[model samples]
Target: MKPILLLFIFVSTLFATQYSVIISKKVDVGTLSAQQVRDIFLQKRHSLGNQKIIPLNLVGQEPSRIAFETDVLGMGRDRLNTYWIKQHFQGITPPITQPSHESIKAFVQNVEGAIGYIPSSMVDNSVKVLYEF
Candidate 1:
């Protein structure tokens, strides 16, 4: 019984996902409120002060994407898909999608005003992390 419990804990830790919200180092906005992060991702708010903000999303089916949507965006996959579809009808668009965490890091590093969430393990000095979850 103790062995089974230990295995369960190990497996749970192995599959756990940690996410960090990152912005270009050039972006002057320091840290952001959780609400602000949600708004940015949802396209409710665009620019932070004078700097134009661009949010990026990981491709569908990525665990980090799942975590970010569930935790930060406060929406599940089905609801988020529905929301974007409705926005498309209104001529509003969702954030650009990157295929991987590495791609997101590279893009955020090179693009001013870009923001994205990636696995906390992938973070480095190239971008500034604004929040973590």
Candidate 2:
């Protein structure tokens, strides 16, 4: 029975599809703590490890965006949207945006100081995982 219970927990964890925040290998800040990555993605910080950090994001309606907001930024979708909207009104556009995860990965690879998030399975050697939740 204990083995069955353990298996149940493990399987549930897997199905939860834990998401990860990732960056390009070229940006050598090393793995970021959850809070540090949160600050960067939320646009609260401009630099990390001597590199001027530029946070990239998926489209507003994308599912991964919600997962990233909840898991990494600790904000609800509505609150995040409001936050960005206010930034936009204040003439500060939110981090660079991409239409899809692939585009985000591509942009981060080509640009220095760029960071973004995607599903764990989608990540590859080209990008490095900074944090996971």
Candidate 2's TM-score: 0.82
lDDT for each residue of candidate 2 in 1-133, tens digit (9 for 90 to 100): 9999999999998788766677778877677888898888777788976889889888777878887788778899889879989888777767888998888878878888888887788888988888887
Model 1 lDDT tens row, 10-58? 9998878778999988888788888999999999999999999899999
Clashing pairs in 2: none
Worst 10 residues of 2 by lDDT: 17-26
**Candidate 1 ranges beyond 4 A from true positions:** 1-15
RMSD of 1: 2.4
